[model samples]
Target: MMMMMQQLQESPVQKNSLFNAMDRFIGAVNNMDQTVMVPSLLRDVPLDEDTEMSSLKSGSDDEESDMYSYYQLLKSIRVDIEWGVRRAAADERLQQQESHKTLSRRGSSASTSSYASSSMSLSEEEDSEDEDLQKQFQYHLTGLQGVLSKLTVQADSLTKRYKKEVGIGA
Candidate 1:
């Protein structure tokens, strides 16, 4: 029982498992899907001997080392979320710009087709295509917004967990 307890307390299996889980979490966060459920990223905090060893070499305390690890992880997560948010916002802006250009082109085409009755059918087809494009763009924008919301929630949860672990608040 003592041997088992020791193994459980400081096992390579646990560390490797945690690393694999963290990698998967990072990958899923990078390629987010609104339709799929986001996996819980938080795991039971293991006493990280590796971090402690490195910190010992640098003459830092245990608490400082743990806090440093948490800070780095949180920083990385924040950067990734920010990047995803920025990308989605940029995509939405580009879509809006394209929609505006399409509208302007349609306006000009309508004015010219006023005299050319034969091209009026083509203009109607273009309008239908524009509407379809707009719908598709809106759908993508909504999905992105959902993804952003999920990420925000995940970040908030992580922050709360970190605070709890560090004994910051009730």
Candidate 2:
């Protein structure tokens, strides 16, 4: 037992901010699981009318999902986070070779209008794309922050709502 304690003490510290956030997220989700014992109670409870996450379940923009679905979604997200599963965005990591081929075709075309329409060099186009990529990074970061904020609120709301439904009255 002393050896085990010393081995544990010798382990490196987890000072990374991302890891800290993940730890908090996992703890909150665990709390939610404990609070929401009877998930059937959440079946028809509607989430915020904005329906952002529900839309993701279907192609339709105005899909109606109940609190139960949201609960499952949150749990699945927690699993993904815990397992370090990362998914790429729809527009992420465009093929640079394909882009270069397309750009080269545009620049080296026989039509004068094609050349006259845009006088930007290939390097300039690449630079422009790089700038756009930077903007996209910032945009995604902002969007992620918003989504995380909403999810946090949803998690707390679910826990509270579950408690109320279960007659715990928190």
Winner by lDDT: 2
Worst 10 residues of 1 by lDDT: 33-42
Clash count for each candidate, listed in order shown: 0, 0
Q: Rate the local accuracy (lDDT) of all candidates.
A: 0.53, 0.69
Instruction: Report lDDT (Cα) of residue 50, candidate 1.
Output: 34
Whole-model lDDT for model 1 versus the true structure?
Answer: 0.53
Instruction: Give the TM-score (vs. native) of candidate 1.
Output: 0.34
lDDT of 1 by residue, 17-136 (tens): 534444445554443322123223323343243332232325444454343344345446646554554677779999999999999989978777664555457778789899999999
Candidate 2 vs. truth: CA RMSD?
8.1
Query: Can you give the TM-score per candidate against the true fold?
Result: 0.34, 0.58
lDDT minimum window of 10 residues, candidate 2: 55-64
What does candidate 2's lDDT look like per residue over 13-37, in tens digits? 4332345555666676789999898
In candidate 2, the residue pairs with backbone N, CA or C atoms under 3 Å apart (3 or more residues apart, or in different chains) clash, namely none
